[model samples]
Target: MLSKSQIKVITRLKQKKYRVQDGLFVAEGLKVIKELLDSNLELHQLYTTVSFDGNLDREQRITEAELKKISFLTTPNKALALFKIPASKTIDSDQFVVALDSVRDPGNLGTIIRLCDWFGVKELICTTGTVDCYNPKVIQATMGSITRVNVSYLDLERYLKETRSPVFGAFMDGDIVYKTDLPTIGTLVLGNEANGISPEIEGLVTNRITIPRFGALQAAESLNVATATAILLSEFKRKG
Candidate 1:
């Protein structure tokens, strides 16, 4: 039987303010919860309708009716787990990095994190205005890749200014990424959905690169930020 207080706490975690205050976040589904359990993140509690084999110290078996009440998803998965938000590590300058300038979509941010993992990019830096990586939607979109990638939110402009490696910003008017020689170690900056890179961050970009359109008319205004990130990461890795 789930207690009222437990239900209330789980419901509050859906909001960013409460999540921040508690320093924890909720992950649903068997796969996501298992992946998080295997990773370094500490599990605060696990509430499940089905039997799970891993760490039993904090496990609670709950009924489906109770699960439906606490779940953020329209259709609740068999399980939901609360995991401690790990501390952000210092930005490592040795490897290629990806930075975001106010990208607000949770799905975009999640996909970008997965891309970073797939492409071997070590760290993802996001501006304060960017969507929180811990947002439930973002975590769901990421699947299990969130555990493999390092995401840090900070003042992107200041971080750009201080970075020793060259900074590359994605722009429509910039040199074609395929034609440009990308360095192995540099910061690839991607901007917001509607707006491109902000003026302040753009000023810090050492190089501006673009993915060219192959179609005859070139009618598309811009690539989706996550798609743009995939292409850019491939180019950088290919050249390096």
Candidate 2:
């Protein structure tokens, strides 16, 4: 049974300020909560509607009706957990890493995080303006991979310059992604939703790349940031 104080705490977590203050974030769904337990992130509490065999510090199996009271998910998943957002470490230049340049939209950010985990890209460096890694929407979209990857919000430009690895940028009219040679190491800079790559970052880009478009079909400006990221990651991993 959830205490009145516990209810208050969970309700407060919906806001970013409280999350930051408590140094904890929410992850919903069986997959995410299970993966969170498996990952390095710490599980503060596990609220479930059913019995869970997975390792947990404190597990409360509430009713489906009770779950509706606490869960932020549209359909209360089997489990929901609160975890501490782990601070990401510095980039190891020798290994492949991704850097985000103010990529907004929590879902997009989450998708990118999942991509990083899938590609085995351990380090993700984000500009100061990028969305918070622990945002619920981003966490939701990341499926369960959020636990497997280390996401760091940092001065991307400074890191890029200091690391000076084979920094690559994705642009609309840039070189073909398939045709261009992509280095395994260095930062892959993904820009904001509408504004592609920022002028400041374009200067830092050692390699400019674009996903090849297909047959003549007058469509929207370009692919969504998440889709673009998936393609880019696939190509880089495929090549190197």
User: Number of clashing residue pairs in every model?
Assistant: 0, 0
**Candidate 1 structure quality by residue, lDDT tens digits, 1-240:** 998999999999988999999999999999999989988989999999999995489999999999999998999999999999998898897789999999999999989999998998879999989998889989999998899888999988888888899999999999998889888888999998999899999999999999998877858777899999999998899765
Deviation from native of the Cα of residue 131 in model 2, angstroms: 1.4
Query: Candidate 1, residue 65: CA error in Å?
Result: 1.3
Which ranges in model 1 have alpha carbons more than 4 Å from their true place? none
lDDT of 1: 0.91
What is the TM-score (0 to 1) of candidate 1? Answer: 0.97
TM-score of each candidate?
Answer: 0.97, 0.92
User: In terms of TM-score, which candidate is strongest?
Assistant: 1
Give the clashing residue pairs of candidate 2, or none. none
Worst 10 residues of 2 by lDDT: 85-94
**Candidate 2 RMSD to the correct structure:** 1.8
